[model samples]
Target: MVDGKGKKMSKSAGNVMAPKKIIDQQGAEILRLWVASENYREDIRVSNEILKRLTESYRKIRNTFRYLLGNLNDFDPVKPIGYR
Candidate 1:
């Protein structure tokens, strides 16, 4: 694992990123998405750039869901709504 500064996370180096801290700031879902999106075949860097991009992605995902839900609020399951 690596720190936000791109340094290897180590206890001796005092550069470890605590899970609780990250969860508290960015939420566990974001952390999970970050981990799941990474390619485990190689070393991963957890820098500010990566986090920023992930945050933006998460926002987009959330907005998409919100838009879907909002648009579906007036739809009835018994009747099919034709796509325009």
Candidate 2:
């Protein structure tokens, strides 16, 4: 993985970002999304900006699902209402 500076993450450089630390800070979903969004064919870059953008995307997706689910909270399969 590379850092925001485009340099490889290394313990000697003090830029290592551990998965457990990221999960503890931003939640496992964020970490998982970050990993999923990266291109497996290339080196992944981890930075504050990338994480911030990913978090926003995650929120949008989750909020959309919540809205759709909320609209179905009172839905009944047996009752078919005519469109107004």
The model with the greatest lDDT is 2
For model 2 the local lDDT of residue 47 reads 85
lDDT of 2: 0.90
Local distance difference test, per candidate?
0.81, 0.90
The residue-by-residue lDDT of candidate 1 on 1-84, one tens digit each, is: 876555788889877767687788888887898899987886776755777789899999999999999998888889976889
TM-score of each: 0.76, 0.88
Model 2 scores a TM of 0.88
The stretch of ten residues in a row with the least summed lDDT in candidate 1 is 42-51
Q: Which lDDT tens digits does candidate 2 get at residues 15-38?
A: 998988888878899999998888
- CA shift at 83, candidate 1, in angstroms? 7.6
The C-alpha RMSD in Å for every predicted model, in order, reads: 2.5, 1.3
What number of clashing residue pairs does each candidate have, in the order they appear? 0, 0
- For model 1, what is the C-alpha lDDT against the true structure? 0.81
Q: Considering every candidate listed, which one attains the maximal TM-score? A: 2
